[model samples]
Target: MGRNTRKRRTPLATKIVAGAAALAVGGGGLVWANFYASAHEEHGGHNRTRSAAAQVATIDCPDVGQQIRDVPDRARGEVDGELATMDSQITDAYQRLATTRRAQAGDAQFVGNSILGPLKERRKVIIDRIQLEINRAGGRADDNLDELAGCQGRPADQMQNGGGQNGDGGDQNGGDGQNGGGGQNDDGQNGGGQNQDDNGNGVAGPVADDFIDINDVQPNSRNSRNGLAANGDGGSTGTFTTECGVNENNLFNSDNLIAAPGVDNGAHHTHDYVGNQDNDAFSSDQDLAAADTSCQNQGDKSTYYWPVLRLQDGTQEFDAGDQGGGAEGNIGKILKPAQAEIKFVGSRQGDVVAMPKFLRVITGDAKSFTNGDANANSSWSCSGFEDRQVTDKYPLCPEGSQVLRTINFQSCWDGQNIDSANHRDHMAFVQEDGSCANGFQAVPQLQIRLAYDIPAPTVENGQVQNPYAVDSFPEQLHKPITDHNDFINVMDEDLMNEVVDCINRGEDCQ
Candidate 1:
């Protein structure tokens, strides 16, 4: 054996194979034993499982670059509707103030009234509100907008960990959890939605079921009519009318007539209603389809009463624009102080000028003009040879001149009337006789009708109750015109421009 020791040893390759086989069998037996023990332990009221820490694997190669890209851009914006409403209100206030100063000359029914009026009080309130809005806008002017998802600084849906993002972000197993680890946060939540970036603007929410078309709105209206839906659309029982007293027979002939903003048919009366002032002008346009143009048949009255329409660019302005009933041959236009300025002209005594005195301007009454009629009495003028004075007859324009249908009551001759000596006063009748019970009295402008013509009151014992001055005119008007004693005049370029700016900006100026 010693002589052949190398040969006697087992072959090297053969020995290695035998050892591998034995090792495999031994490992298999151990694995089986372990499985059996675990199963038996569970059945015997004893169990062991991997810890949560053991289950969660460390996310390697987390793709940090792609994860960062998941964030949204900065988001925020302002709500335009609220801004517009406020702007309109502000503009209205400016216009009202200017109108009051000019129309009412800043005077009042009495001293107390001058201090407290709708325009004055409302204007103050609007100013305060505008200031608050401006301050709020300042905070959001430069904030990151991409994040804001709702009105104010709120988000549409809030995320765990105080951010708008949610889900266990790339925590483990490539789960659906985007941007974070999965599972709801253990703490209570505010449900605040998402945080808005800078600029009060946020992600838009779903609009309400009701919305209106703005283009279809009439001028001076907050209401809209377009986009209305009904159970059906086809035939309807409806009627419409305009300020000029339109009828169904004239539907075809009426110009500028259009569909009304809406129709509100009552049980007894069926008619169309316009929400806006400008839209109201077209109320009867549809109804006029059955009629013919009759303005041409009325002589020179075919044209406008004031010739104020646009005709400069080779435009055609004809009698067809007489839907307003030819302005009733008595136009009454009111321009607020913001639109036009009024100045007084006085007489001159020597080199120095002497201002004339006017009591107050009268307006709103139906003034008539009878231009071309002849009557008795002869002072023998070459044209008609009659003693008729200008005032006695409806005043006429000069020969071949057009009569002015509307006149702005700018200045005044005080509250006095020329009733020949025995003629009872006519100016005072409107105020005293109570004729205008249902009538509109030009409530927009500062106004005055004649003093009441009732018989002089009898004062008993110590005092007369009316407290009105006997001479009729008050001391306030007796002095020459000035800011304190005159009407508040706001008609100027600056004020008008301000109003226009606010309106264009879509602010709540009202």
Candidate 2:
């Protein structure tokens, strides 16, 4: 299990079709219809009552990070720590809920009384600490934060019914419900309650309904004008492709520097990291700038990471018995991506600006399962069937077609700050008319195209044989909708300017 010695798999050639908009000049301006709006929210918020014997699928807690928008810079560290503590509290409560199924079976209110109630109490204490720290730093704290302390127990059906779903599912920081909505089975996939057992998979989620055949899916893709004109021309038409190795170095960690900086296991799930070699919760900007990179060009030392994908074939990996791994219900063997393509394109509206060094950008919501798809920007599709993209369910790729995970980062910047209080406000996606809002400048948009040579899991009889899922917070239930990616721009100044220049001039550069 040496870091660089992991077995490498060859990838088959696959066309690239990602994000809300198609790449204008880098790859051909291939149009794409997205699945952010209606596909996943079909059964969400129907308010069906669960039977008394219904099983609680997972613990549903308010996203504390989403609610706190005014944390002072001086108090961000402590508030972040408290938020990390609340996440750990939820993880602990979820573990208790998952393991004590028998006890829950006997007591009708067992989940509410033992798991959710205790979780809420702990969250209240952490919420108080967050508000206190903010106020101590001379910032006005939200007086109604106590409302976010209460947690709920969602049954499998409720989870299947995702809450507060909206069109486009691209609200980066704009969902209101504590438990937004649940997964659905609109395509005749399994939508029943959880199994009494773990269904032979050590993890708690990704039930049969979590997957659908790509061929069975209708072509719901539409051409999006991400920053491009309706004719798919004009604007910054160039692209800069960076050759970052598919994290063959086994650079993995559970800490999230952007959200829960300085906290151990902040993500509560392992992430596959490429680009920057020295990344952790405690890594400073100085540390990242001096770190070695996995990219072919030493000047482009940006950090790119995402939750590790695992195949549930009963193979125990390195973190199997550790926290953020099997202990938190993320089991199975981690799968390395067959190909990792990192490309940066310009805005279609006008010339693009260089991203400031050390700028942090996060795309897709890791908590999309409970937070709703308002901010769900990631998409899943098969190699050949690129026209069919799914936001909620994993694609059951046909034979010879690879599984692809596509993510397009927020392309518009607020111009003033490199980081925002919510880690999202500083960045925005392009509007429908392919223009950035007032005061926001268009920046080079990073798009990730990752392909995996995974064996399509056999789904039949409401059971999965070898399911593959992304690492996620335990409560997120390993749903495909919860898949997300993270990035920190550590590129040197010269290379970044070159990226901007090449993009503005409409030339493809590497």
Best by lDDT: 2
Model 2 is weakest, by summed lDDT over 10 consecutive residues, at 30-39
- Model 1 Cα lDDT, one tens digit per residue, 1-510: 000011112111111000011101111210000000000112112121211111111111111111121111121011221222222232232222212222222222211132122323433343344334434644222122211111010011111121112112222222212222111220112121122110111111111100111222223331111101110121111111111111112121111111101111000001111111111112332322223322222111110111121101111122111221111110112111111111121111101111111111222111000000111110101112112212111112124322111122222111332111111111111222222122212111111111111222122221121211100001011001100111111222343333334323333231
Looking at model 2, residue 51 earns an lDDT score of: 25
The sequence of per-residue lDDT tens digits that candidate 2 reaches over residues 1-510 is 333212212231111111122112211221111111111222331211222223456666667687678878998877877878877777776666555544544555555666666666777788888889999999999997877776665654344234332212321111222321222211112222133224455456666667778876668662322212211378889999999998888888777889888776778888999999888777789888999999999998899999989987777677765566666667778999999999998876889888999899987888877776656776889998887887777888888999999888888898988888778889888887667897899889888989999998875444567889999987787888778888999989999999999999999999
**Candidate 2 RMSD to the real structure:** 11.4
TM-score (all chains, Cα) for each model: 0.14, 0.83
Model 1's C-alpha root-mean-square deviation from the true structure amounts to 41.0
